[model samples]
Target: MKNEPIYLDQEENELLNEIENGEWVSNPLSPQERQAYQNNAKYTKSLQEKRQTTIRFSVSDLAVIKAKSKEMGIGYQNLIQALVHNYAVGKIKLEA
Candidate 1:
């Protein structure tokens, strides 16, 4: 069969052959390096940061929201932001 380069180069091919023949290679990371990595990882919680958001809603509110959005014609979230900001800052009130 013709010599073919499927994935590995010469050094990688040698390493694969050594592994296939049951030879052992030294660990790339020492115990201290492994410990440092474990310490830096987020084990118990997800990462959190501020971000822009979008949401979908029901048809009636969506129609009103979309028509108002077209009149303004900027980012659709801007109207949502305005309404939420006004309500949150006590300019609007919830009926129920």
Candidate 2:
């Protein structure tokens, strides 16, 4: 049996060429640093997990949201998600 050659995208091909040309250097991390990185990755992955919920919106507000999202070249749900995430992370503040 023979194995077929794998094709790589432009970025992947460039990385492979650099590796083959000895342009890459290895810098091993310490055990503590590695563990810290692993933990951080796990936390980041958890933060990215999504759950679905329902919310009610007025027809006019929803229409405006859809129009704005379309103008921005994104879905209204994505715009809402970004807005919620920004507010949750304190990037968008509500004046009270």
Candidate 3:
């Protein structure tokens, strides 16, 4: 799926420019904010768990997967992982 480009308004652009220029000073977060941040970090980390493995694919097959991965703006390994996971979960089926 293609994502529409986000067009930032003038105010938003100015805020980005200000941050890039280092004019905005960031303050330390409150205790509540820190706790919320830590919780979020742990949750995100859990969702990102992955293991490394090696596999061989024919050059043509790899080319197709790589092309689709580039179009999806994700690493080819991630694309392969999702494809395998979907097939395992019956989200996708092989015709043959």
Q: Top model by TM-score, which number?
A: 2
In candidate 3, the residue pairs with backbone N, CA or C atoms under 3 Å apart (3 or more residues apart, or in different chains) clash, namely: none
The residue-level lDDT of candidate 3 at 79 comes to 98
As for candidate 1, its clashing pairs are: none
TM-score of 1: 0.39
Top-lDDT candidate index:
2
Q: Which whole-number lDDT from 0 to 100 does residue 26 have in model 1?
A: 71
Task: Give the distance in Å from residue 27's predicted Cα in candidate 3 to where it truly belongs.
Answer: 44
List per-prediction Cα lDDT, in the order shown. 0.79, 0.96, 0.93
lDDT of 1 by residue, 1-96 (tens): 478757888998899998999895877998999988877675423333336676778889988887889898866577887898799889999999
Model 3, range 1-96, lDDT digits (tens) per residue?
Answer: 279887899999988988999897778999999999999999999977987888999999999999999999999998999999999889999997
Clashes of each: 0, 0, 0
How do all models score by TM-score?
0.39, 0.53, 0.47
List candidate 1 segments past 4 Å from native: 1-50
